[model samples]
Target: MSAYVVVELTVKNAVAKDLYSAAAGPIIREFGGEFIAGGAWSALAGVQGHPQGAIIRFPNRDSALGWYNSAAYQATLANRDARMTCSFRLIGN
Candidate 1:
């Protein structure tokens, strides 16, 4: 089965968040995740008022979890935490 990581983010500091985004891409790719979409979006139906949403698809749940838990990704994620308000979910399919 495949998996997807869905993230809702509100960036507090764009300049700092960009650093996380750039460094995080390679880590995601290493774990077989592909970027689906990311950036500002209008809340049309669910979860109103948030301006940012991101989705990434992975080969499977294990890969998704591995990526998130890996040392390299964890390091990058710290920057994200500092620069943004966000919620994340990993969905299995």
Candidate 2:
């Protein structure tokens, strides 16, 4: 099965968000993940949710979990303190 990590977040600090994305992107790709969407736009319906959202695809559940547990991603987490609040979901298909 293929797995995806979906993230919805609100940015509190632009600098910190940028720093986090910069540091985290490489780690995500290192785990053979691809960003499906990472941007802002009108919701057009229902609850708007967060201003920022992203989806990343991985080969399987293990790859998704591996990226989440990786040392590189853990180091990059320092930039997120109060910078943004996020909710993540792991989906399989």
Point to the candidate with the largest TM-score: 1
Record all residue pairs in model 2 with backbone atoms less than 3 Å apart, i.e. clashing.
none
| Candidate 2: stretches off by over 4 Å | 41-45
Residue 88, candidate 1: C-alpha displacement in angstroms: 1.0
Q: What's the lDDT of the predicted structure labeled candidate 2? A: 0.86
RMSD of 2: 1.7
- lDDT (C-alpha) at residue 63 in model 1: 98
Residue pairs in collision within model 1? none
What is the Å distance of residue 67 in model 2 from its true position? 0.5
Worst 10 residues of 2 by lDDT: 74-83
Give the candidate number with the greatest lDDT. Answer: 1
Q: Can you tell me which runs of candidate 1 are displaced by over 4 Å?
A: none
TM-score of 2: 0.85
Could you tell me the lDDT of residue 51 within candidate 1? Answer: 76
